[model samples]
Target: MKKIKYFYNTNTLRYEKLVTPLRVRLLRVFGFVSALLVSSALVIWVYTRFVPRPTDKVMEYRYNSMKENYATLKSEVKTLQDQIAQLEKRDNEVYRSIFEANPVPDSMRVKLIEKKKELDKVEALNDDQLSNEIANSLNNIAARISYQRTSYDGIEKLINNQEAKLSSIPAIQPLSNKDLTRIASGFGMRIHPIYGIPKMHNGLDFTAPQGTPIYATGDGTVTTAGVGNGTGNHVIINHGYGYETVYMHMVRIKVRDGQHVKRGEVIGWVGSTGASTGPHCHYEVHINGSPVDPVYFFYNDLNAEQYDRLLKLAATGSAKSFD
Candidate 1:
């Protein structure tokens, strides 16, 4: 191969020809290109080893932050689960006490037992060992909600039972004060006014003038409010829950059968209409068809001193007939 070169002399303004090898010039160009490639490779390698790329640094930082956040969330969930368990235990104790105080309905008791089983199942979970705190918290929350609902149901049942019991008790005076004057006769063994023989008396007799008011002992329905053979002008009230009150020897009946009567409501006036010796009210309390002392039932309305005095009087009093 042939090569040509030119030289210039500035002072003489002349050109000169020089000789060079074509192979040598080709080799020199190849060498320069190779050196340039090697330098580029060195730069790339240095960048990959030490100088971090923007996208790579961002990705690394994001991964580390995610790990830290996951750890914190797991710890918080564990704490919440512990608190829930404690609250559920306390609720169980309260419910147990309420159940003992007032018997729970069978259906409610079954539901409460089921809720307790569910709580036990949640407590038995060992997911904390596997670091599954989220699952544990979710289960604990569900158990707590179920327990709370069951407790509310128990309370409602207890309230309903108490209300029923309270409704059954006689809480009002059977006769008005105007109609309740002196006692014409006492309860227990007494001489019958009409028969003139020793007999059992199951009620108290109140002497009052005619046209006096007679009140109901409690809220009830007037089952029978008319004259009978021996109890003329009678009023029988069914106060529910195995309690029945009888008002005999009334002057005149004011309420009809099947009439709804409230506490302190007037059913009749005072009178001695039947086998009585004088104008008076015959008040009696029958529990499940058996007569009980009416004075004991009125203890709730009496003060401490009044109740004690009345008890003393009852202990000292003897069966005497007003006739």
Candidate 2:
């Protein structure tokens, strides 16, 4: 260690100790602290950026599951589509050709082909992609809506009463993939979440955020669009041909009674208004005014496993939060 040197004062003839200046001491301290902070910041950045986060792992797992499910759905859709095409071919060869009636235009078939191309291009859809895919599909549907009401109104003149060109019934989902949500509860008998008693749940409960848009599964006229018993702010559509769809627990209703709505048209939003559980949509399908399983009819784009899971979830979901 070096000792501090002292200076001798000739006037007083005394030894005086040499001291460092205040500014220099302060600068040294500031520099050390600045280096330490920089090193710590680098270490944190490396750890957070390089290491896997929990959310990432979970998302990866979900994405993998969705990919598998989507693959299965794609196959099923292809098979169903092949069956439909075969049926249409049979209709044209055996039925339409006999009367020399032209089958539906290739424009509609071309749209279907475009949709299939879009579906094939999607390997796995993330949340945003899934939302967009659904939105685009619905928008496409809305943009190219035919064979719904216009076909039914003047059916005698359209295609000589051909059933192949008409898809008037509710064959698709009221809530498509974009608005698809986790099952809150399902149809059939279950213990009431609130009342705590054995009861029959007439619809599939979809857990969604407030203000999530709800759509009409098929082309229909709004038969009922107001608050009802137990269900809050509900909308019921009459698809004719003895088919009806009921959407309950709406935050807001976009249509009024007697108003016509096409498939994929927005009608309402998810809400916790009526029976009072949480934000969700309670959906029901009816045939001749009798409630039927809504889950069976949502075959718009779900894979088999996803559809099966929906059925399973409805069957095995907890008996809670139905209103």
- Candidate number of the best TM-score: 1
Tens digit per residue, CA lDDT, model 1, 139-160 = 6766776677677668767768
Residue pairs in candidate 1 whose N, alpha carbon or C atoms collide under 3 angstroms: none
Lowest summed lDDT over 10 consecutive residues: which window, candidate 1? 175-184
Tens-place lDDT per residue, model 2, 41-136, is: 999999889998999999898889777767765665575566556555655655465578875665888899987987776757766577457557
**Residue 313's lDDT in candidate 1:** 52
Estimate the overall C-alpha local distance difference test score of candidate 1.
Answer: 0.73
Global lDDT of model 2: 0.76
Candidate 1 structure, TM-score to reference: 0.58
Candidate 1 at residue 92, lDDT?
Answer: 66
TM-score against native, each model: 0.58, 0.50
Q: Would you list the C-alpha lDDT of every candidate in the order shown?
A: 0.73, 0.76
